[model samples]
Target: MLEDAGGHVRDADDDQMRLECGVFGAWNVAESSAITALGLHALQHRGQEACGIASFDGQLFHTERHMGHVGEAFSGTDLVHRLPGRYAIGHTRYATSGASVIRNVQPMFADLEASGIAIAHNGNLTNFRALHTQLVAEGSIFQSTSDSEVILHLVARSRKGSMEARFIDALSRIEGGYALLALTNECLIGARDPLGIRPLVLGELDDAYVLASETCALEMIGARFVRDIEHGEVVVISGKRTLRSSRPFPAARARPCLFEYVYFSRPDSVVNGRSVYDVRKRMGACLAQETGVDADVVVPVPDSGVPAALGFAQASGIPYELGIIRSHYMGRTFIQPTQGVRELGVRMKHSPNRQVLEGKRVVLIDDSIVRGTTSRKIVRMVREAGAREIHFRSASPPIKWPDFYGIDMPDRDKLLAARKTLAEMQEILEVDSLGFLSVDGLYHAMDAGPRDPVHPQFTDHYFTGEYPTRLLDREIAEGRNDPVERQLSLLVTA
Candidate 1:
């Protein structure tokens, strides 16, 4: 769904937040770079910021990173033909926190070192700037503002010999959500952050083994789905053997980012062995439990919220109504040339059905509210449609914190709930009532069935101030994360 000039999709017939990224990788293969692009095309749903593919063919590495949609960037059949070799990794990105610039493209490579390290990453790192600054102080230079570059510098300085040992050691230094697909001439490595904020799964196709951000991508490339890469698991695909190591650690708490189920991931995919659709539907059901209401109709923001909206309607026995009509033909709004246009475009993208809202108390189910700009806009549209009363229900609890793990998003001030009470948000949006799902509701949506297997590396810092480990100090007096954020805090001085 990538737009031609700018990288965006036209919104068609829905008023839901589009999930933000798409990623894919293939290694130990006969045709690496070409196949990797195919994988990326499969994952085109995860990101649209930029597209890239890096391949290694035993002796040399090849790469192509374009500033626009994947097809437009790599469309020349001659170019695809020229992209030679077998072990490859590809990425499509959406700026998680940073702005969209060629400065933020992915699959960045460093070939000066013997085998080299090429990294394609999904998810934000809470402390990338800090890590980058530390590297720079120690005589390292950077080419892009991307956090993925920090990983390459770490690998470059990694203990000289083994790639696995070097990557594992450096992984300990990074704190945030990551599903990294890294390529070296000798190996293809897939590493997930301690919390597993993003999804990366394993699949097998013919003689080739694949790793991708979702099952849908694997299916698209005719790969057989294996299992998902577990939280904190690092799977290294070498020429002859696939090595995995998950041993070295004190037990870390698992609090996976709840947004994946609420709005981010593709509904057809699975994360942590759970179907995303089922999990989101459950969130909707949970919302219904908390906001049991007597309403004339139930309306869900299109696309992402449909599952939850369905659950809410079924749970409350209120008939579902298609109140919001989306313009599927509309291209992605953000990629619009101007910010004012983007803002105005959101309204043109989705329209409220006046017939459904007229004289009726309507229940609105949204996945989550980030800054409340989109929510407020939707409210205004609904009110203009003559809805008597609008009950707002968010499937997930409020997003009070920013994601450091590569999700392009607002800082603290942008979050409506971060600065105002739910009541305040309701008033600002001009809605009749607002209720959010509980934290327990979020966990249950992903936990599933009788056996709730918790991810070993999940971190819920967005909801809670909690985060992962650090370079330790034996003194029991005080402790904090490896100070990655503390180091980045200095950059604000610039």
Candidate 2:
């Protein structure tokens, strides 16, 4: 269940760490809003809390933002008709920065002296609190608490000559991961951060140019996948169908989030030129090699674990089976507003199949263990189903650090691996054994060989605690009377 700004609770079960948002934009296309809606639908797994689309016709900009799934918000409505335009951008939000309020929904719009602009962002800003505090002190009025709103304020306050200049100016001052899509009357703009921590891909459909969080969005609209937007590069599609490219930031090595393959992105999506499904399967194969266990059957914790289980079974030469049946009708238990209900919701979502596990020694493959609460419950369920012995395998390395960029990871004290050893975790989960893929093993699966201790290839702070960007918020979080930390602790669980 989720709680909106109105303090009302609703059933929702998206338990994974929340991705900040998904963004899509198209330039010089008929019924641009409809195209954007389709793109957002394809990228729906990235976020599910709220969604919005903004389109710019020759005369005016039209917008529709709502708090719900993309299909429920955009299907069979005159809302598309209201947003007639040749250029548009859309966002699906998961609320990492602000409260679950209607005002916080994106395609955040602003009317500046230069022109009216609407922006949709896919990652978090690490220096948001400092910027927000400064902006508020300067008499800027904020419509919502979203960090993406800070970009608008920065652009509006810039002394730059044109909209593009102001936009670049705003991006330069910000630090952290971002894949941004902006729509204006004359152009549609797409940008990736200097480090390329988030993903943004370019695509082509007839005469139109497309920018989306993943290639799946392009596939949904029958667009041909182009290349990924380069780190620090900006592409602008003008009204006359002219495409211009610029590199505004200094050159830096790309480091896209590794978790996109492990859990966040849909298996069908391709990120940074690598197939997500292929990478996940490789992760499972690597896990099997790292710690191959003796078990009668390899069982997967349904859905997300399916691909990994296949790879594990293939590598270990053990038959794979669906030992846990997940109920698609059940909502994600993570969104349950209350602790009691959240725990109960897990049982409703998954059940063990006794027919597959009567007397077999089962090896269970899962993506990752966050708090170990759900894993513990799943182990108990398997035990009750008469499994002779249980062994748990995790596809990714131990998640020891909190994700400040976007993923809603628990605090250090709350993470199972952070507080306990591997043996301790096995005992706690009541499994015969527990194994996690090492950091180097994860890199090997990506075909990148072992990770460079001094210069890693990807942003994997969740496991390594080696953040790619400066943590300005960490300073505030460490303060004696820090409201930011308190608020984060409360909002993170929600």
The TM-scores of all predictions, comma-separated, are 0.85, 0.92
lDDT of 2 by residue, 1-494 (tens): 45421122423333356577899999988888889999999999888889999998887888899988999899876755888878889999875323678999999999876689999998888878777887798899999878899999988988888788888988887878899988887788899999888899999999779999999999999999989999889998896668899998778989989998898888998898899999999998999999899999999887888888889999999999988999977653245567676667667878889999989999999999987878888998899899999999999999898887777666676678989999999999999999999999999989988899888999999999899987765666566436665454323210
Global lDDT of each model? 0.72, 0.85
Q: What does candidate 1's lDDT look like per residue over 261-336, in tens digits? A: 6767778877777788988888888789977878889998886679999989988899998999888776543455
- What C-alpha root-mean-square deviation, in Å, does candidate 2 show against the real structure? 5.2
Instruction: Write down the worst ten-residue block by lDDT for model 1.
Output: 1-10
- Top candidate on TM-score is 2
